[model samples]
Target chain A: MKCQDVRIELLAYLNDELSSEDKVTIENHLSTCGFCAKEIVQLQKTERILKSGLESWAEVGEKVNLTEWLQEESRKLSNKEKKKEFTKGFAETKMLKHKWQKVIRFAAVALVLVMLMASYWPQLVKASTQMPWIGPLIKQLVLRDAGLSWAYEHGYMDGSLATVEQDGVKLTVLGVIADPTQTAVIYLVDGIEEDFSVYISKINGDGAASWTSPATKTSVGTIGIAQTYPLPEGEHTLTVILVEEDRDAGRRNERLSLELVTDRENISKLSISYDLDQEVTFDDISVKAKRVVYTPTQIMVEYTVIGGTGVGGAIPQEYASYLLTESGEKLYRVRSYGSHIADGVRELYEVFERPADVSNLKMVIPVQGKHQEINIEFSEPTTIGILDTDIRFAGWVHEGNMIEIEMHYEKYGRVKSITGWSVVDEGGNTEELTIWKGESFGAYENPGDFAWVTTKYELEETDRPVKLIATQVLTIVEGNWEIILPAIN
Target chain B: MTESEFMERLRPLEAYLYRMALAIVGKDDAQDVLQEALLSAFVARKQLRDPQYFRPWIKKIVARQCGKQLRNRGTVFPMGRGEEYVFDSTDKGKRPEDHLIWQVVNQLPEIYSQVVILRYLGDMSQKEIAEALGIPEGTVKSRLHKGIGKLREMLEAEKGGLANEMSGR
Candidate 1:
């Protein structure tokens, strides 16, 4: 067999899936060909490594008591089945009676409403005229229940109307609500003959902030966009600019710009602070929960990791930290970010959605007590094409279709930032790749060090040349922002 | 079959099911997945046509249950950041290398990971894996080959990294 043919069947041969003749032919090739022989050896080593690494039942089953657990589980299943059967029968009978009762009640209510409306039409109109908001109030209630209203229902302070009309397209900003965290604007669009995309380009605010364009499009010409920012206490002006890109025209129109000021009184007072200062030692590391700020939306825990490894070294494994309630329910960490606070100490902030009525909350840190570390050597860096002066491919680590390439850069060079990259196939098809920030192996410590980017693509049977394309490589620019949070009491 | 009959049939596969669950979702979620699979198997007992296919059928249910859990958690194939290999430190019988293999298998894409777990950990034949995954035997064979190739690459990469660390790089 040829080398390519032999390589393809190497796994099948090792698996003993090959026919007798094919097996013998591969054996003969292996006996003569050193490269194929080495390939077979590596394949065998991988199988052995995989089989030896898997946790067999015999190794860990003794502690589990599977038979007893199964018995208990079966009992629970039987009881649950019984309860379900009973509930199903009861619900059917109850539903029949409830259905008739609901129908009768709905009919009576409809008849009464018809009679009342016929007699009270003039009175209702007079009342609605006196209370000008009554018509919009009912519409608002209907919209709120349908999940269409966001500003007034969500305690957003109101703003004035701003309208912009251009080229038969009319855009109106109905109202707005602003707070420290987000500024929500409700807008209406009319005379849109074609589909268009709307986005907020700028939010000139006092504090550092960014705008996330609304993903949901408006089919009924009404939409809202919430721009998130750290708005300090007191009034702050948000210069909101809305841009509409018409799909058919292929042109973007700057619709309107409005300065929205936040109402200090309407801002949420639902924030509470707690100074934990609780420290727990796990193995070689000391984890301290310094403080916790609880808002209605999220709970932020600021903690520090002391004494273990330095930055870019062995950090804690991905742990699911959460707030344990008195009822033993866990609200898991939704998102987290960390930075080096001092020598041997790293400050990590974890945020979790605030659980309703959660009292006596205990912050559970992820401490594996003991960790088994498996150290593996990565392949040497392969020299790919260089992008600028010093930025180039350091090497690549891959498994199956997933490949992570390391791009090395000289410290303090002209290339200040590498934002994104892509893998282009021989067909010139480009797939954007993400930076591999895997804990142990892929993370880059310093800007001058190599950055690991990963992409997954199908490997064709025929050899196809591929190139890595780096995008948004910024030079001689500093990308930094500061957010100063007030001290929580 | 009745619930009792299903329970009796599943009893022998409990240990296998537990290990597969642990391998897929890690220790924190393994028990829940196993219980969910068992309950689902019991609930759908009437759908079982052949008693002979009980083992593979139940194993398929368990695999699907793990997939559902992974989906609900919003994680697809390939381990996310900080989700590296974590061994049960309390299991003195487990070596670091064994945990490493479990981690590697868990990190495999769901399609390949399911097949690998079923074949090796479940002691399932290729035909059994094909039946469990509702895929053709040829597809299972190809996935197994590709999965093994990926496994070899990952192992080699690790070996290279270990050598670099040992060499004081």
Candidate 2:
């Protein structure tokens, strides 16, 4: 090896890393070459010195006890485990406490239910006594042609009756009915087959109709008679009379009169058993066209079918129709279905009943004629579906851009789309790229001012002072179109 | 082999491992390097092909650990102003003949100091040093030769050594 090569390996030689052959060669050269030998000596001396120094330092280092430190750490871990056990126990105790509370609350609720049942005890007992077989029976009495009805209930006794004459008219009394003093009064009046004006006067006390009859009018039946009357509670002697007109003499005379003996104590037992649960009434159905306007393309017809459940529970289904003609000739005629069994559309062809679930429909009649006549009839009630209108959007302009808008862009409608579509900051800076129709449509440079252009805006640029607003101009084309934009606050 | 077994085997090589760590890092970071090298050897114990060469293997681990530590730490003091003259056996209590030599060593470029440490502190052969640092042997020689010569010149002015003849002496 050359001297240079030997010097390069000298440190390794001192450290005994060189191969035996190379070491032998280096040692042989060292024997002859003081130059390389001294270099090796100096390098060794440096190592000896550094080794001694480091050895001392290592000796002085504090000895660390790895096992003791690990033991301390393990102790801390066990303490944490103990604390976790205590916390688990506490949580379990709290859960048990909550369970007991729920049980107590349930018991309190049961007790309240028991108390409520006890509070309504008297009502239960009374209801049981009033059930069909237990309480005193109410007797229904039907009087015919006398233009009256009389009934009694709850231990009513026999009543007295008498006849009387006044002004050449004679009236017969049926009797005075009595009640058990608990519910109501029962009056028994004689049945007069013909219509007569009857007046009753209480000679002893106040409960009486003390007046004279105007005339004796004959009746076909007793359907018009009213059973409800105002009578004071007391004992009374009533004189009732039937009056008639003496036509030849032109005089009014009494045909018959009768005395009814009854007391309030006995009459109070009477109970009027009315089957009021059954409601009876009638409905009047009428049809007429209210207003009619005829146009070439459309005939605006407003017709009202008047019908209501009057004095009746419900109105029957009614239908009516109107006919249109040009110069008295047939044009278009439509009517509602006479009576609807199904829920059909409320068109002019279908008819509906009064007191209906859905009532009153306004129809637009398309009249092929200038002059039209309406015909109407009544049928069954009907239900009509309600209708609502929806709007759509077309396009708009903001600033220098053309903004296409739908109902979604309402607030921007009045504003110029050229100004509103392309928003620019006060500094007129927009980081966004202006996309004119898409690239598929061939992108065009915004000549800044054009009939159709698109510009983009950056939201941050407009945040500074001199706040810029987007002025939108919108063009609403066609019908049922609107812009849905926020009102400029 | 387990990490503990690897470290146990390296117990006999503590001096050489520390020296290699010192050669790569400085005094301030040598301990961290030694510990880290031991850990790396433990994790890669299965890959240790030659168990008898464990000392050199540990030395290599120390060198790599030092380098990674330096890179991750970033910015050794600014360099290239002058050469640092270091004496290995100098007592910590005994100040240097020239106190500025340490400042100059810090000022030397990392490239020069790196080779200087490997040569002087590690006592490594140029070829071995080059292999560990992944540089050319010639690069190691050049860096060491120039660094030592510059250090000699810097120290000659304060000490009695001849600037040119110190390596020869």
Candidate 3:
């Protein structure tokens, strides 16, 4: 038995639960392995030494009589009850003596409580905000997220949460929590009554363009526009194009801008230009995370997809990527923008959520570009192959001039989302197919859980016997890379 | 459950409940805590889901009473929290073997120490600990692991800070 296997059964072995054969095998393994032996010793020591601290039921149950004890307690309560009954005889005299004193004491305590609540209302808000370690005794009397709160507990928050007024209604930027797949800007709104969609219009800086989130309302008023990848360093004006939804008046677009500054001094950003030079292959594509960076905000990994295009049947076109933390926490993409350098070669930048426990950090990228041709006719359901998720062609509906090609987008593990797909007719004509966007959010809004999404596409007039080819399939390969991260001091 | 039925159910487990109270608030207040817990348990007997759940359910009330009694004692430790405050604080040298475990108790926070004591000394499972404390099983597991890890670290005496903490006034 291996050390790990032996260690798992060591507890049972100590309790004499394992079979004789398995026990002998574990004993042999323990004799050879010091680690497993020490584990058993530690477990035994903890049980033996700590048992002295407790007086168990075996000792007290026989010595103490349960029936007599209950009657005794009952007798004590009855004595107190008799004393209370006796006191009732002088109730009128006692009440007259203590009425004014009691009222004065009650009023004084109530007044003190009210004053304390009024003064510490902001501190109460800080306590509830999820910065784990900060105790209530920090003494900074501030509402929302104070600078001292983040600085003391979290150690670093580049652009700490701040409130801004848009027109008359106010919205506070809670904090920027990012991941490669979905980088959501978690925020809360105040004063505004109607529902609104918060999307980052533009972040003015180098390599700073944050899809995220088609504005998702997480808690009561907390909304985050999960911007994919990492925002560039330094101060930048974030142009938030807030779209308020009104059932009667349709939708109203309100542009509220806020200045977001990534303070480097406070943030524990270690500029480790360390290249891991590792690669994972999917079909003919060689995808590898070359450069890595860690800041107070997020962990960024720059990877490249090297695969020839139009290879047909072998190469994947599009991919949704994510990185796993040491604790196996899956950080999905909130938003990301890729730059195409050469044919079939693209350089994409993505940021993963910084690990709370960064012991064994690992990144898994399927972001493999693809091309799979499956021929489909007018009236039959077509399915894509080689992909984790089964993208099936449900049916089509006739809408005036154009027909809406309805497809059932079911998210399995591999591919997270589908932006668009191309249908090539036999006569060499291409039809423009897109995930139809309407009043309700498209496949992009909530990318993580694509449980059962009905995606409608406006198919252009195409020739018969058309080939429905998936432009991109986000299928993860068997290859995995373990990136040992430095301590985020 | 009726008052008599509640007393009947607590018959065998009263000693164990008394032990938990004794551990949390010491022997001086354990009897008071036990009486308070029994009174509240009798009053709140309706909150018990089933007859089978009476043990852990009543134990949870006992723990809460222990906490309330401790708070009422008003023994507020300061910033460093150097003073040992929990678990039979009066019985300093009851047994020779008690020193190491008591030192461990002194190091840990009240919550973590309670979980550790229940797990190791009381010989309770993580699920049982959660049931007794009225916490999620995940929280119990985390606290158990954290307590064990902290205890192991302090026992190994690898950290130089441990010497200062041990020897400091």
Candidate 4:
């Protein structure tokens, strides 16, 4: 091979990315040429330099304060009582306070939740509402979305099954609640300390379903699995596989799996038959409530967007669409599946928290707003006005190698969502600008076109002639249409 | 994955993710970007059903988060002189800003810089880099080759006067 050709392939050869033939050829050429051989050594040194340079910068990963993040996330989800405490407690743990706030075994390869039969376990309890050790946990899950924990207190669990011990762990089905719109499962485990990875190894139902089990961070041994859609409503097979992984080897060493027949049924068999044939409009966008079903597990609403088409592509006011209580509390949305059913017909199936105090409930759909992307030339402090919002590029803090750019945006309470942004330097090198919510801004009374935001992004180099692109800045439309949900029962 | 579990997977990669983020975004935003990427990985944890793909999965998430900060017409950070240090782990008498390889790598195009960063700083295999960057392995091979070539040339040009280009590495 020629010196030029061998030189081009040297990196690949060093990186072992070359075929054996190319590798041997490069090796043969390097043996004969000192310049090419010296070049290979230089390339190797270059790799080392780059690695160490980046590593020095990466040590700042220690600066990422997850405690504040946990607290903030908890604060965001504080609307829900149980999860708020769960996340809050996780935020304050001494273990999490360790370096990088990192701990526990890893088993990212979770198949899905498993199954259990009535006759599997010796202590399987059926047709009983005896709140098990973690029934109250599922109670919170049910109370928030399915209906309210009141149902568990008043009635019985339809399929409370358990499984025999396998892989040094015992799993008991604490409570199972299934409505047509949503399904939830709360299970109590006897073994498994430390947040070892638990996966739903196999879910064998006629219909497709997935579950999100956060490993009951606050309360160990109790896991609450809930989703917007239910599995096939009959006897179905499923398996919960618990994997004990050896991180060093990066593979699962011991696996415990128990398959059981999950008799999927709506334990309460009661859904609030609420139907509203009403239209609400804000500006040019109109939202009509087509079909509203209140299952114990979730609130399923089929909303038809009249004039709010192509505003954020099928999801008009998704961030603003939620079930609002008379007391002005926003319910958490579980999932929003928006599909184009047919020509001129769009379907948005939204699942949200259904509070027990089902009084004066309204489906609030705000008007879809028109937004614009703007580029700001900022080297020093600058302020730009977009509609009613004032975005101030505050200042820069040069710490070590990072240039911290502080930006604050103040608008109304409604338009507080940070759209998107990116930065570029004088060298034409694009930066992945991560504008974090540096500090919390108190409430604002003014109606906003954008939002009240204080954000910061760090750059290694301040190549001048910087441009900050604030994509999707202002919401031009204002006004929320609220449709009072009336009960048919 | 629980927060702790996510953190566990992230523990080993904290420095790696930070490097990748810093290489792409810079310092001031590395913390925020790393946190944002971690949160994103946690949110999308369910999608990662294979344990083996965890590293590549998280790296891809961080890269994608950086991808969001992809506006091409701006400059940020005055390059905190204090933060500029040699890749030396030790705080010896060596000058930090002489990180020539680091300086040259950044000047490389995004295509090469990303491949190189993911390979060395990320400690990722060529295949892993391919998976993380969503490129073919063969493409990864070519990009790494070209990236190193530019880096080496840039190093030689800058260090023509200096005898030892890499004192630390």
What TM-score goes with each of the models? 0.38, 0.25, 0.31, 0.38
Residue A93 in model 2: shift from native, Å? Answer: 48
Q: Tell me the spans in candidate 1 whose CA falls farther than 4 Å from its real position.
A: A19-22, A56-66, A72-489, B1-16, B25-95, B164-169
Q: What is the TM-score of chain B alone in each candidate?
A: 0.57, 0.54, 0.54, 0.56
Give the best candidate by lDDT: 4
The residue ranges of model 4 lying beyond 4 angstroms of the native Cα positions read A1-148, A160-169, A190-194, A197-239, A243-254, A258-268, A274-290, A295-299, A304-360, A367-479, B1-169
Q: Give the lDDT of residue A449 in candidate 3.
A: 47
Model 3 stretches with alpha carbons more than 4 Å out: A1-152, A158-167, A172-188, A205-228, A247-252, A268-273, A276-283, A294-300, A308-371, A374-489, B1-169
lDDT measured at residue B137 in model 4 versus the true structure, 0 to 100: 79
Q: In terms of DockQ, which candidate is stronger, 1 or 2?
A: 1
RMSDs, each prediction?
17.0, 49.5, 24.4, 20.7
Candidate 2 steric clashes = 64
In order, the interface RMSDs are: 13.5, 49.4, 24.6, 20.3
Candidate 1 C-alpha lDDT tens digits along A10-107: 76677777789999999999999865676677667766766655645324642333444445545644575466554324532221111000011225
Give the DockQ of candidate 2: 0.01
lDDT of 4 by residue, A1-489 (tens): 665567557766777877898788888888997767766776777767776766665554432334444444434444545544443245422222112222223232321112233325566566233333344455544544334354466563455565557656765655555555544555555455433333344456332233333333332344555332444457656555445534334345334555555554444256655567987665556667787777665676777765544421233122236688878877635555554445434556666667777678887765555545666556678776666456666665543223444556453333323345566656787665533221223333333333333433334344455555555454545455676877545
